[model samples]
Target: MTLQYIQDKEGKTTGVIIPIKEWQSLKEKYSELQEEVEPSTELMSWQKKILDERISDYFDDPENVGDFERTLDDIEKSL
Candidate 1:
């Protein structure tokens, strides 16, 4: 597998990077480690619909811009 180096924002090399193929394989294995998880097309579609509705609602409500930003921050923190 191919590999490369990761860099910092200041253009300094930080560490080695795994190749994309290996990274994907690692991800699959990692997910498998969490055996409780299952594939869910229906949940994914529902989430997509909810996301689309929220985005459209954001555009409709100017006052919600700040709420949207805070929501994003909360989601990021949760991640």
Candidate 2:
């Protein structure tokens, strides 16, 4: 693989340029090299139970839930 350096007006190296094919190949290989992790069965069971309870509680008092879309819009505006 050959790398070409991009220079600024003063000839100072600021970035690099590589062939598109080489870049795509590198990206593909790096993606394949990522580690895969399996969630623990015990922890997943506990999380599922908690989520189910929350859903049940929400249904028990549907009027108590705030406007989800408005809440999300407010959050995005704040960010």
Candidate 3:
């Protein structure tokens, strides 16, 4: 599975070249990765908390809450 890189004037790789057999083997191996990889639990939890707080704060304004809820409801209904 030998691979070679073509570099540019800046010495950065511009492209890669692999044998057909090696490319075929790589394709077969990659095809086995059929599942969506979930993010780490801690990261996901932190993201959820941050999003929830942002949403909560955005809706805390009386005028904005009505528009936000209406927009959210419309989006949910469309979904």
Candidate 4:
């Protein structure tokens, strides 16, 4: 990978210049790096609470967690 640095008038490094082909290849390889739309304020708060509660429950009783293989078999049967 090659990198070109952009400098200010004072010769201080400010930005980078990437070749178009290299940039395109990087974009394809890391498509998920694209900007994401954030959830609404209310939805974000609700999701945080739900996730916190789930983590707490899991830690409170790790033994009570569902069996992975059995859960998959049950799901397949339902389908």
Q: Model 2, 1-79: lDDT tens per residue?
A: 9999999999999999989889778767877533333344565778989999989999999888888899999999999
TM value for model 1: 0.29
Q: Candidates' lDDT values, in order? A: 0.79, 0.82, 0.77, 0.83
Residues 43-74 of candidate 1: C-alpha lDDT, one tens digit per residue: 57788999999999988985856666889999
**Of models 1 and 2, which has the larger TM-score?**
2
Clashes of each: 0, 0, 0, 0
For each candidate in turn, the TM-score is 0.29, 0.39, 0.36, 0.44
What is the lDDT for 53 in model 4? 96
- Residue 56 in candidate 1, Cα distance off native in Å: 0.6
Which candidate gets the maximum TM-score versus the true structure? Answer: 4
Best candidate (score: lDDT): 4
Candidate 2 lDDT (Cα, 0 to 1) = 0.82
Residue 57 deviation, candidate 4, in Å? 0.5
RMSD of each: 11.8, 7.8, 9.2, 15.1
Instruction: Identify the runs in model 3 with alpha carbons over 4 angstroms from their true place.
Output: 32-79
